[model samples]
Structures are given as structure tokens and as C-alpha cells.
Target chain A: MKIDTEKLLMIPGPTMVPAEVLNAMALPIIGHRTGEFGELLVDTTEKMKKVFQTKNDTFIITGSGTAAMDMAILNVIDKGDKVLNIVNGNFGDRFAKITLAYKGESIKLENEWGDMAEPEAVKEILDKHDDIKAVTIVHNETSTGARNPIKDIGEIVKDYDALYIVDTVSSLGGDYVDVDKFNIDICVTGSQKCLAAPPGLSAITVSEKAWEVIEKTEKKSLYLDLEEYKKKYNEKKQTPYTPAVSLIYALNVALDLVLEEGLENRFKRHEKLAKATTAGLEAMGIELFAKERARSVTVTSAYLPKGVKDKEFRGLLSKKYNVVIAGGQAHLTGKIFRIGHMGTAKEIHILATLGAIEMALKELGVKVENGVEVAEEILMG
Target chain B: MKIDTEKLLMIPGPTMVPAEVLNAMALPIIGHRTGEFGELLVDTTEKMKKVFQTKNDTFIITGSGTAAMDMAILNVIDKGDKVLNIVNGNFGDRFAKITLAYKGESIKLENEWGDMAEPEAVKEILDKHDDIKAVTIVHNETSTGARNPIKDIGEIVKDYDALYIVDTVSSLGGDYVDVDKFNIDICVTGSQKCLAAPPGLSAITVSEKAWEVIEKTEKKSLYLDLEEYKKKYNEKKQTPYTPAVSLIYALNVALDLVLEEGLENRFKRHEKLAKATTAGLEAMGIELFAKERARSVTVTSAYLPKGVKDKEFRGLLSKKYNVVIAGGQAHLTGKIFRIGHMGTAKEIHILATLGAIEMALKELGVKVENGVEVAEEILMG
Candidate 1:
């Protein structure tokens, strides 16, 4: 069957953007130093704080989520500083890599890819290393569809001297992240995930405690320097460098959509979507990848049916049904597939994606049935 | 008179983007890992090579131009490495700052803001600093509207053992940048400038010699690391991190527009536009800021007429005429104003901008005459 050329993006990030947000991005470009852009920057930063559930000073960086994650670490962890990294999935491991790259001593608390970081393990590590300057964890591990217990880790770290840093790149709007309430010192998120905006822009909220460390740390990066950003924002309500102006416009509108839907409502919708996706996949005889308690609310990971090739299945789904999904990364490649239902994804997208997966599996000689029906049951309920 | 709320950006960067390029950016977001996006990435990179007029390996980065500049310096200069930075304007000084931030000793070859870097001075400095690992210069200083003689400096630097790094952030697409011919080991440019694409993405070209230096340099930045980007691109035609997907789409189209117009034709157009802008300003009794030999072909810097206030004049232009221009940066603030005539700017924009400036100057009681007519004569001729 021939499908429309526009393929639905069900990958973890660069999620489907809304027309309103896209239109906002399509608006005429504006100078970053202008008062008009300053107003936009201030408005977007304020709205972003609400989504983060924090009153901490937030900065919009013109790079990927990793840039924000890098900034979060590089600003606080000076050379030879000890940092505790909780690694459960790909992005979690990335923090450790970034820490090591900057010559910081990284002590990682490890977990299986499909499992969440244990709060007890993080506490034990922190207890062992009194010199640890920060504890870093990924709120949602998009690679394995696992959601870590960031709040629990935050609680344990707050009592210690180590600053609490969390990468909420794929989970900020889709999941509840009470940064201030959880005593998070630094929280980072990207625009392309649950914000339903274009990629390339990331935001980080910094508490006063983080600033204390940042101010004392030696300058390591000119572009990712948070002190310069804070100074510029304080003086003119602008970024130190020219920002991704169009993406800023898009993010402003995306924030409007998120606030209009309400944070709780958005989280509920993501939960419902995750439930539908998992239910549909399980009903189709596909095994869920992540542990039940660690399942992510934005993306769902499941094993391919026996005898179904990963590339063939995904290609067939994309070419024949115009549905796009993600394959596993690193060691899990070709063993699992991930479906993202975050941001602008709706009940219809879930049904269509499930139907596409079932069709592909059946065509590949795997016994599968009632996937869309099961998804509909959960979504409608 | 009341004017439309839509602003016409005449800033040196975040230049005006065409509607077509903006519409391309509005397209549905695609997963970066998809074959479709890979194809787009390859196409854009290939076309970018053409615009750069080089056969060197180029990578698209997900941050502003400063990120690329930072990447260029940090990737090559290790701690205590000596780098010669030719400072003629703000961006030139920025290169020195990035070097100093990374703990590299910066030797400055200082030129006045409105003057070009002297080739003999660069050679003399290189002769003195035989241990210098690199020499950095800005091809076009956006802050001062001065175009340095990159080819001349490139010729001098090629004889030295040091790598030649050039920041062409505001010049690449609108000016002639023969990276290979100029022997630039590393060149950086931003998307929002002459590319006429939305701000946020920057591209860097690394020569084989530059890669050798980069490979041996200690890791300082994880996000701006060039090695990871090269590895990812060589393994699969993709960025190491998730790219600004929408901006990439927009850039693909912008490159198409650029190539369609032809490089020589585009350069000619830009030169003509620059001529018209300067003529218009001069006719309005404004003094050009940059020296004759150093005048940039992308942005024009001019001193405000007697009794003309920078903020008040720009405010009148923006509020009454819906035209926007930039004020001087750093120490030059409130003393001069800059007019950008790059990217999608044409004769009509130049005329309109000139007329608005004339009206503003007249409102401030400065005598001005035939500015628009003079600009039209240059453009139409």
C-alpha cells in the first residue's frame, strides 16, 4: 500500500512539532539584541521555569540537550573534582563520559540498561565519597525506555554536600519534575522532546547553590560558560551569544500549548499514552524491554517478535505504513525497538503506530493480532 | 505614522530569511537517525562545502557560531599552548578570550577596530613566536564592519608550522571564502548570517593538518568535541548528537537558493548591495566607520550624524518605519549604527532602510538629502 510521504516520527526525540509552534518558527527572524527578542526570551524563560517546577534561574542554550548536560557538569565540576554519576541507560552513561572528559573523577553507580538507578546505590556511593562535588542522573533514559527515580536520588543527595544535577531531557513536560521540591540544584531539558518544539535548543535551571560552585570553578569553556549567560541576562535580558532565535520563538509557543493543557494534564496524557503503547505491544506477544516499575512515560521499548529482523520490520513499517520508530543503541542494537508517544502524539498516533507494528510483524510470519484494538481500549478508557 | 508590527532585521547576524527557507523549516520534524535525515545531512554538507569553496571535511554543529569558534580553539590548543590571535574587532578579541579561557597563552597582534590586520605584522609575530601552535583571525569583523585580508594572512601563515584558524561567521555565504585557496586549516561560520537560515546551527571545516592537532589535544569540551562528530559522520552520515533538525531542513533549502543563484552571482549581488548601502549612508551626511580597504561587503558600519542619538534614531526607525538596524557593540555603543545588507536583503530593503534612517536623522534635526535616490542609483546601475 502506498503511504503519504510525511512519516510520523515516533523516535524518542525530535518529536512531532505542532503546526502552531512550526508557524511561530517560520515567522520572520529577529535580532537577538533587540528589545522584542528580549521580551520573548524573558517570557519563554519564565514559562520554562513553570514546566520545570522551579524558581531557579533558567538559561536557554543553543545546542542539543547534551550541551545543557555538559554545561550542568562542566560548570560545577572543576578538574580533579569527584562526581557521582548514576548510569542506567545511554544518556546516563553520557554524563559520566562528559565528567571524565573534563578531567573530573567520575564514580558511577551502575544499573542494568532496562532498570532504574537505585536510590540506595546513589546514597551508598555518596557516603563512600565525601569529596564528590555533584551527583548526576538522567530522569528518563530514552535509549532503554527506563525512568529513573530522580526524586528519590535528589532527596538522598540534598542531605549531602554534593549538588544534585538531573538530565530531564526527554521527561520534563511528559513527567512530573518538581525540581525545587526535590531539591534539584541543576535540571536540564531539550526543546524537541515533550515540549513539542524544534531541536537545537536546551534549557537549564540553576539554583543558587550551583552558582556558588560555578563562580569558583576555573573557566573551562567560553561558549558553555554559565557565568557569562547569567551576566548577560541580568544586564539586558539576552544571551551572551546570538540564540537560536527561531527555535526560541517555537519554544515560546510550545510552552503556551503546554501551559494551556496544564502540567498535570500533560503528564496524565503521557501516562495514558505509555499505558496504551505497552498494552498494545504486550497484546501482540511482544515482550516489554524495561522493567515494569521502571517503564518510561514518554517512550516504550519492546523486543521484536521471534524471527523478525529489526531493520526489515522497521523499514517495512516506515515504507509501507509511514510510521517511524527507533532501534536500540549500542549493545542492544537490533534486539529492541522504541516507540515515542510524547509531545504532540495523540490517541490516533498510538493506534496507527500499533497497527503498523502489528502489520509488519504479521507480514514477517509472526503471529500478532488485536494490537490496535488493545491500544484503543486503553486510550479510550 | 503608524507602521506594521513586523520588524525588518538589519542586524549583522540573525539576518532576514526568505519565506521559502522559513517554510522549509516549518516541515514536520524527522528523526535524525532515519535514512531520510541522513540523506538530507549529506546533501547539506556537500552543498556547504561548495559555499565554503573547500574540499575539506565539514561538520555541522548544533550551537551558535561562538560554539564553533570555541570548538576550533579548544580542539587544537592544549593547556599552556601559545596561540597568536589577530584582534581587529570584537570577534577577534573573542578568539583571544576563548584561548585564554582554555588556558592557552594568547599573543595578540592588535589592530584598531576599523582597520584590517596587517599581513606583515602577522608574519613578524609568527617569526617571533615559533612555538605558536595556531594563529586565529576573523575574516570579517561583524562588530566593526571590517574585512581582513584572509588570503594575504593565509599566505603568510602557511609558511609557518602553526595551523591557521579563521572565523568567517558573518561572511562565508555573502563574501568570498576560498578556504582551500587561503590555506585555512580551520574555518567556522554561522547559519543566521550570510546563510540566511535561522540562528542556532554553525558549521566548521577541518583540514587534515588540523585533525592531527585535534587528535593529540587533550579533551576539554564534550559537546564541542570535533573527534566525536567526525567519528559519527564517518560511521554513519549523522551528527554525534541530535542536530537541529528543523534548522538543517531550512539550511538545505537556503543552500539550494544560494547555489541556484550561483556563488559568483551571489557574491556580486552582495558587493552591489554593500555599495548601495554605503552610498546611501554617505549621501545622508553619515561618515563610514571602517577604513576604505577594510570595508566589509556584508554589513556597513557608519557614524551617526551630529546630534543624532543612537537609541533615539534606531527607535524612530523601528517604531515609525518598521525597520530595524543594529547599534555598535562594546565601547562603540551609542556612537555608531550598523546596517546589514546580506542574505535575502535586496535593493528595495536597502532603499527602505536608507529612507527610514534619513527620516530618523531629519526628526533629530540633522540635514539629509537624496539618500534613497543615491542608493537606488548604485543598486540600479
Candidate 2:
């Protein structure tokens, strides 16, 4: 009954969970008390700060990345408060929707699907909204292959006393974002993505300023009560809610793996792999949707060739190549598809994914050049 | 680096996750959009219905039992909505606090710790408040070891137009809770307690009547939004947001194990275990904290001797015999300890826990009979 994962999971989240990490999760569930539980929490939190590259308090929620987004927005942005949401792709829109649901006056600054949220537009919107209390944006958009200029955007929100809430869902361990240096009041990451754990928990951090906002704000939330947790976190290394204990165990292992690899090395590897992935796709005459702001790693969104269907290519990849890739969302459906190379990925994985694409293209009668050749040319380091 | 857990998890939740269920969780992460994902959702939902004993629409959330309680309240009860919350233990107070946070006018029906919410008290309260929209109660109070009579409480709320919401956190699989026959509108349960899965996601069912109230209510929520999930569940068997995929896999396996044991036999076994546990404890001259209402098989609170401290006894039990038990909360702290025998329990575990308790008492120099002989007599039956 013990099933070993045969396929290396390369999906965006729910990424490859190492055997050691899985076994760590299978540790007998202990009471959320005991010195053992406290020691685990303290160690996990301190290690989390190492990855987040911030001294600010890190609180892990027994939920998903979206839940973290909800926590960040619901707590920081008070109802009827002016806020600016920069939407570039799916995740950005989700943040905007979340901000709107919190009764925040959401002023949207949007861009084309492939484009990044422009710095000029954000600055302009901020200049106009004198009452704006917070401005939210995603560091990495999982839908489109784009990494926004979060550091630049974080700087923009600095002077205005507005809280900078960053959704670094797919970018956390792949690249570094020092929340303290960047003046980010709120930063969030998921366990399943670059952290390379199973999908269950979302790791979050809030600044002193952000905590102040949360304290005064009215929340209809009982689950993501940040202050409640912060209170408990201050006293005992415990969450206000019953946390996903096993997932926390898995996350600790994943964090250890990331640290062992070293952050700079991991980021550089992602950069190299991303370039190779883009090179491989272009070799097949397929243009990626997000050409201008193409992210270094984690995910890639590429255009489909004429008469080539995305669903067919994905199916063929799954059935024949034993690979899985994401198709385009609404309005871009059948036009583009996304491939991910997050935690536990390397040069070899991108090469295989492109190799599958090559086979799929040939079977679908699309004229294509060899992919691995181009991939090697870009990734050979 | 791989740590194998042979130590049985005898706690109320994160119960002994069988190896097969662990294997199921370790299955390769699938694309949430692919047919593979759809198949998992559809299959899980059907099995869930069978387990819940309800034909109502049920959805899973990546949260603890507390989150389920919050979602249940937030969805149906709005600002100024009158709610009657039965508070007898920690979890019951959780319901009250959550209701109050939502700006819901809740009547707190105070029941003694280690006592169930009285039916006559509920009837009297209901007679006074025609504005009451919902009546909330916990099925099993792990904090006090009391199982509320949902059958009688449901009948109390049945005559009124108000919906009945129940927290079956520790008793869903261990005991029979007929969601349909009991006239329960909303029921929430956690995976770890009796379901024998790790703690991460919580499952809840909403009846058609509850849906009507939720539909009419205008509330602002994002991550815990039940309405958003309802729209997606019917079409895609997908959550509006990404889910804790692997935990769902674990639940799938855990459900198989529970259904295999069958409800009737499972409940009978739990009842027998409860009887034996009480008889054995009494034979050793220890008094039960919840004798007013029979202790639930899932969890039960027991008082220590007047001279011996609960924490000191707990220390002896853990250090000597490796047995873990729940301690008292708030006012009850150091006065009582709780033992769980919910999931994956056999005749031996109960005796082992009792044997440990006996040894701890004797070591603490407390007056006590032979723990092993009394426990053995009850267990042999």
C-alpha cells in the first residue's frame, strides 16, 4: 500500500515531494503542545525567515496560497478604504477580486495578458489616490510567464505609507525577496510551488505596520485572523487555529532542501532553466505569450502554432510522454499553454518537456525544428 | 532522513493514518484542470456523500474544523442575524466568538462544562427568539468529553424556521450522525479526528434550506466563500481556489477504511470501548468528569485525584509509558485530562493507556487500585 511517486511532479504547486519529506509528514501526529511541538514551530519559523530573507514574523496558515492572499487583504485593507490593485494576469485579478470582496475601493491598473504591470501606471494611480491605504500586486504570475518588478513597485508604495502586499506564490524560493529591504508589509508563499511541498499550507509574514492596520480593521473573518495568531505567536509558538501539522512537517523538510541548495544558486539555476525553456520553445517557432516580462523559472506561457490545438498537445503529452502542462485561461484559450519548472527542477526537466512538445508538434503536422538542440545551446553552463 | 512512525497516534485528530492512505497521498500531483483532477473530485464527492449520510451538496475546504465552523456561520448568518450558540466547552465558545465577530447577535446558551446542551433549555430559548436564523451545537466536546444529543436538538429546531448547524468534529465516523433524518441543515467535520486523515482540510454539507438563507445574505468573503465553491463544485468538481490536493487523497483512503469497517459495527465498537474505558477507570478509583452525560468514544475527560496534579501525572505518563492525553482548558486546566479512542483503536490501546495511567498514579504516590488488573478485566470483555 506504500505508493512511491513514479512521475516526478513538475506541476506549478503540488510539486515533487521528496521521499524524506513525505516520511517527515507521516510522523505520528503529536499534540499541538509539548516542547516537541513548540520546538518544531520555532525551528520552522526561524528557517522560514531564512528563506523569506526577512526578520519579520512568519506565520504559517493551514490553507493554500489563495488563503494567504485572503489573509493579507482581509486583514490589511479595511472596508471602504481606497486601494490600487495591479492586475497583469489571473493571480493579479484574483487579488483584485479579493480586495473588492473586502469592501476595499478597488482601483484596477491592468495590462495586456503578456505584459507586466507598468511602473508608470502604478505610480500615476498612487499619485491620484491620496486616500489609498494599500496597494497590492503579485511578484510572480503563475498564469502568464511573468515576474513583475516587485522591488520597484515596493519602492513606489514606500513614500505614501501604503502597505505593500506581495503575492510571491511561485517566486519565493526560486528567487529572493527581502521583505524588510523592500519595505513589504505583507508577503505570502505557498508550500506546493517553489517550496516543493504538497499543497496544504501557506506561509505568511506581516510587518509591524501591517499588524497595526489589522488591529484597527474590521474583519468578517474567523479563520484567517492574523492578530489572533500574532497574539498566540508572541506567547507560545502556536497558531490561533488548529494548523495542518503534517504539512508543516513536510514544509520544514522542503525548507531544509531549499537551504541546502542555497538561495543564490537556486535562483541562478532557475534563471538558466528559464532561458533554456524559452529558447527551446522558440526553436519550435512557438512564441511565448509573455515575451517582455518572461519570468526566470517556475512557469512559462507559450503561443500555439497555427491549426495546433492546446488541448490535443497537452493530451498527447500526458498520454504518450507522461507529462502534464496547463492550458490557457479564458480569452486566451487554445491560443497558449503553460509549462512549469519550479522546486526540484533542473536543466534536464525543461529539456524533456520541450522534447515532448517536439514529438507532439510533429504528430500534429506542425513544422518544427528540434527543441533539445536549442535548449542545450541556451542551458549548457 | 526518513523517519517511520510506528508510535500510534492516539490523539483525537491526525489519527493513525494507515499506510495505504499515506501512499494515496504520495501519489503524483496532477494538473487541477485535467481529466485526472476531475476524476478525483467526482469520485471523492460520491464517496463523501455515502460517508456523510446526506444527499445534500458537500464541499471540502483546505482548513481545520475551526475553518469549517467559520464558513458555516459566515455563509448563513449575516450582520445582526440572531443565532443561538450552545457553549459547554472550548469549541462551543469558538462558535460563539465566530458568530460575534460576524456582527451576528448570538444568544449564548451556557451549559456546564462536561454537560450537553439541554433540549428543554433550547426549546425555551427558541420560543423567545423568532428572529433566530440558526442554532449551533457541537456533536462531541473533546474539551469536556460530552456528546450533545443532535437528534433531540434537531427536533427542537425542526419546528422553527431556523436552520441547525452541528460540529461533528470528533464523532462523524466513530458514531452515526444521520444528517438527513436528524433534520440538520449544516454539519461540519474534520479529517484528522475520526476520519483518520492528517489535519489540513475540513468537510461541510449544506442543505437546500441553508442555501436559501446564504443566497439571500450579502456577505463579503473571499477564501472561505461557500457560494463561490458552490458554483464551481457542480460544473467542475473543482474548488474556486486551489485545494490541498494530497490531503484529499489521504481522505479518500481514510474513507475507504472507515466504510469497510461499516457504520453500525464501528459505532457499536466505539460504544463498547467507551463503556470499558469508564468501567476500567472507575475500577482504579478515578472519577469521570462527564458522568452527567455518557462520555463519547471519540474523546473523554477524566479528573485526576484531588492531591495529584494533571500536568505532573501527564509528565509521568509520557516519560514512563509514552502515553499522550489532552489537558484541561481555561478554568479546567490542571484539574482534568482527556483520552482519545476515536480512530484506529483496538482493545489493546485502551488497556495500554489505562495501564500507563495506573503506573503514573502509583508513581505520583496517589491512592489508587491496581490499574493493570482492572483495565485487563474490562478489556478482556
Candidate 3:
């Protein structure tokens, strides 16, 4: 059946973009090589650096976050090179897969799906494998709604020879990400997540150490080659190939709104949203999937109610209340649900989503508490 | 100096997008995993196949046309595999580079920049190397405005075991490309260009024959992996990763416009626009770059008149007349200029661009005939 209503996206990514950002993309398409596009590219990239809190060389790629993640691993890992992958969720596991796909030897420090990667485990792996050329981690795992201890792991990996690569696809704009202080050699993020922009464009920051590794590695991908991007950006403030011009226009405005909101304020807002969301779920007798201390500020994952079917509940919520949330991915499918409160999501969205969930649960003959009231209390407090 | 007016895009790929298509992107973002997105994806892909004139398995990649090109090569050619690359322009040369980057041995049949590849030359190369796994060529070269003899080349490649891979990045919607009739094993095109959608999204059609080769080939790239894309499409009508959702929305609308126009009528329109543009330039005492029979129907390239500087002339056209066109790429830089008249570009756009060029030339004190009147005569006739 068709849901004939204005649907609100509460997915982990491709989040709810603001009207201003969405309208910015409706502006006329411009030539990628023109001076106008160059200015837009430069301005957007500079602001992205401020949000990333790094002075490294930044580039915008015309692909999904997976492309940026692929670029991060492929640029540094050569054939037979050992890469240490800290796997806590799907995205972190993807790093391992990318490395393996490129003929690199991946040594995964595996953690439970909802658990965060321990810094001690990473340190032990690095200490054991002296030949490891790169270490990859996900700062915020969208799949399981878990946030890893990036700074703690960074401090441990800094003394090693391996370059530190982090995927901040869901965290850069919603959480505190100090790329330099965290010693992340390569940090990647998507435009649609916390930036509140349209999907399809991803940005990456490369440190000097990462460049050194990239330069020495034999290039395997022509489209994702970092050297070409660096050369093009240096010569002219433009991408090596034709960029997704309209998406960049949307992202430029998204970055403006993000900077205007102030990073600290935005991070605090995300924390509050996460707190309220979890509080409401807990008050409804739902169990949080992620560990308490390592919960993601962007997305919250929780167990489905005992008698509630995954599809029926979400379907009811979407059709009846016009609130769309994400189902569990991969192994977690049918067992849990995730609510994304990043980007343009506000307190009102959290309350509406909780209210919808409460009604949907009661309709299914499952007992639920006043989730809306509990969420409203936290939002007001 | 800034152009203080609404600028028109006349570049080769990122052509002018219709307001309807652009506004379609302004719709709110949706969850990629939802049934709504599934319907959107399935409907868009079916329409895209009609535009591609193929019933082959197609997948939309959330990257630039280059990404599709890379996928075309990387999926079929394993390490040290021999591939015949017919190079006539920048993009053809790029295919060779991608093959070489992936450790494939490239046998290049190089042609002049403004010339199309002769099918006999391709037959000669395939005859010499029976080990050639695939034959790669650009259907329409964007840099030099040359359209290749793809059907002729496809006939020869089909005789051999080599898979036929074509890049229709700049020609798919505007040109006559019957993928099934032409026996194209893997055909790739971008969402922009003749599709008149915003940039960023690219689509590829894979024949059963191409899939057989791809399935056996050792996959090197996780992001550009066609096998994964095929599996994902088979399981669900969704991309393997988060697609540029808004761009897909724009492309859905763009495809509706394309199919509504009918492919035959669209091709005729592009042909007429190209003819008028060329007539105007020739009337102004300019020289067309590509050969008479190989001229592109989407974009027309011509030599810059003597004593008229490339930068200053184009700058005047852009700033004074608010018309944006592309200059020559690579070695042809400063020697030629290109006018794109594909998708959403009609007779009026062609006339306005030519008139702007004439005025910009007159302002530069260059002697010229009334090019606009000449173009009008051709267009009206």
C-alpha cells in the first residue's frame, strides 16, 4: 500500500535535508570547469575543514560514503600490505572488505555488533603486527548505533607506523571530531548525513602522512586515484572529473547552516536528541541495543518490542503517522529498529516519532508507556 | 568580473536542466531501504533501459560517468589480461589508462584527436591479439566532439570472444544507441549530459555475456564491483549503497521527459541543434574541428579564429552575454571551443549562444558575418 503523506526520513543517512539546502540544489546547473564552480568548490571545502576540525588537504568525491571509504583504504594499502581493521559494525566491517578486495591483508580486531572497538584491542593488534601499514576504524557506526573511542584509539595508534583512517560518515557534523588532535590521517564523511544535504557527494581529508603512503602505493583505481584529485585541486580549485554539481550546490548551503549553528551547539543538540530518544524507548520497556557509554549521538538502535513484528510496526508508523524509521541491517534484521535524529531532525521530530511508536505498539496489542511524555520531559529539561 | 545575470550552461555534460527536473530534486529525502525508494529505483531503471534501448540487466551507480567507465573495465579485465583500447580522444585515452592502472595490458589503436576510430583498425588489433578480453571505446568523445562508429566496431568485436564495452556518457539520450541490436556487452552512461538530469549519477547495462566474464574475473574494487551490484539488484530493487537519492529523483523526472519526447524525436532534435550550431560557426568564418561524417550531434567543436584569444573571447561571451561554453581540453586547449546543444537545449538556446558569440567577437574587433541569421536560416529550414 502507498503511504500518501509527507514522509519524514529517519534513516541513518540520506537524512532530512533542510528546505534551504534542498532548494539550493534546484539552482541552475553550472559548468564544473567554470570560475563560478571553482569558487563554490573552494568555499564548500574550506567550511568542511572547519567542521572536520582539520587543516589537512580536503577533497569532495562524486560518490556515496562507501566510495570515500573505498578511497581511504585503496590509496594507502598496496598488494600484500597488512591493514588493521577495528570492526564494531557494518561500516567498520566494510573497511576490512575493501582492504581485502584490493589484495591487502586485513587483520580484523572484531567486536560484537553493538559493542564499540576497544582501544586496548587495537593497540594489541598493532603491537603484534609491526608490518601493518594502515589502521581503519569507524568513528560512528551507523549500522549498530555505536560510537567508538576514536581519541583513545588515536592516542594508541599515533606511536605506530600505520596511518590512522577513520570513517566519520555519520559523526562529523553531529559529534565532536577533532581530526588533527585525534591523529586521523584520513577522515571521510558523506554529504547527506549530519551535513543535512542531498546524498551522492562525499568529502575526504588526507593528512601529510596519508599522502606519503598514497604516493608510494601503486595506484589501482583511475577514478578514485587521490593523486589526480590532489593535482586538480592544486592547479585549480576544482575536481579532477566532472563533479555532481547540483549536489555540491546543496552541500555548500548545508555547510553554511552547519557552521551557523556552531559545532559545539550542534553536537550538544545531537546529544540531547539521542538522550531523549533512548529515554523514551527505555520508558516504553524497550531495550537499547548499543552499550550505554558508547551510544551513537546520531542514530539510536533498540530492540523491537517482544510481540511486535519489525515490518508491521514500522509500516504502521510510516503510514499512520508519516514517520519513517530504519529497520535493523544484515544480522540484526527483524530484531531491532533504529531512529536517526541527525541533520535537520529536531525535538519535535523525536516527540512525533516516539508518539507514533507508542500508538503503533498499542495497536499491535503490545503494552507501551507514555513514550511521548518521557521524550518531551527530556527535550524540555 | 562576475557575470551579474542568470548564466546559461552550454558545457558538454552538465547541460541545462529543466526546472521541473531540478524541482523534483527539491523533494524531501527518503529512506533508501523503503518500499517507496524501491518503487522509484525499479521504475527509474526500467525507463533507463528504454532510453538505453536494452533489456539487459542495468544498475545505477552513485558516481560520475568515470566511475561507470572504471566499472566497465575493472569488472571484465583481470590482472595482466589483454584489452584493446580504441583511443581517439581524452575519454578513450582514459579507458586505456584505467586498464593499465588495473594491471591489464592495453593495446591502443590511437587515432587523431578530432577523428573517430576506424572499425578496420579495431579488427586488425583483435586479429593480432586473440587474448584480448574486451574492446573499449567511447561512443561519443566529449573533449573533441567526435562520434565514433560504435555499431561497426561492435560487429567486429562480437565476432571475437572479446566483450564490447561502450561509454555513451555524452550520447546515450541524444544519439541512436540500440544496445541490444548493437550487441553491446556492457554499456555505460551518466545521468547528466543528454539525459538533462543533474550530475553525479551514472547507469550501466550488463548483458548476460558480460556478466559471465565479470563473474569469473577476480574483483579488485569493492565500490565499483559489478557482481555485488548485480546481486543487490537481484535481491532488491535498490542500490548496494546509499544512492544520491535526490539526484535519482531528478533523473526519474528527467527520464519521464526523455521518454515523453520519444527517443527518435530527441535524436532528431539533437541533430538539428548540432547542424544549426555548426552552420552558424562556419558562417562566421570559423573551422569545424571534427570530420564531416564523425561530427557529434550533442556538442560541436570548432577552431578559435586567428587573432581572437580563447580566454578573452569566451570570457566576453560569459560575462557580457551570460552564456557559458567550454573551451578545448588537454592539447587542444586554447585552439578550439565547444558548444553543447544536447538535452533541454533547443533552437532558441543555439541561436542565443551563436548570437552571443557573434557579439563577443564583434566586441573583440573581429570581422564576422551575421552568424545568427545564417543559423536561423538553417534552423527554420
| Interface DockQ of each model | 0.62, 0.59, 0.66
Please compute the TM-score of chain B alone for each predicted structure, in the order given: 0.98, 0.96, 0.98
Instruction: State the lDDT at B297 in candidate 2.
Output: 75
TM-score of candidate 3 on Cα atoms, chains taken together? 0.98
Please give the lDDT score at residue A80 for candidate 3.
93
Per-residue lDDT of model 3, residues B74-134, tens digit only: 9998889998888999999999999999999999989999889999888888888889999
Query: What lDDT tens digits, residue by residue, belong to model 2 across residues A1-381?
Result: 232344544556657667777767656677676656777888888888998999888898898899899998888776788878888888889988888887888888888777777777888988887888888898888888788888888878898878889999899999767888888999999988888887878989989888888888886688888888888888877887777877888888889999999999998888888888888888788887885554547788888888988788888887888777788876787888888888888877888888888998899999999878989988887
- Evaluate candidate 2 and give its CAPRI docking class based on DockQ: medium
* Clash tally for model 1: 0
As a whole number from 0 to 100, the lDDT of residue B253 in candidate 2 is: 80
User: What digit string (tens of lDDT, one per residue) describes model 3 on residues A1-381?
Assistant: 122338877878888888988888788888889888888888889999999999999999999999999999888888899999999888999999999999999998999988888888888888887999999999999999999999999999999999999999999899999999999999999998999998899999999999988999998998999999999999998898889988888888899999999999999999999999999999998899999988999999999989789999999999887989999988999999999999978998998888888899999999888877888888998
- Looking at candidate 3 chain B, the ten consecutive residues that score lowest on lDDT are B1-10
Residues B230-300, candidate 1, lDDT per residue (tens digit)? 99898899999989988998998999998999888888999999999998888877899999899999999
Model 3, residue B130: displacement in angstroms? 1.0
Residue A113 of model 3 has an lDDT of 88
Clashes per candidate, residues 3 or more apart or on different chains: 0, 0, 0
Candidate order, TM-score descending:
3, 1, 2
Question: Considering only N, C-alpha and C atoms within 3 Å, which residue pairs clash in candidate 2?
Answer: none
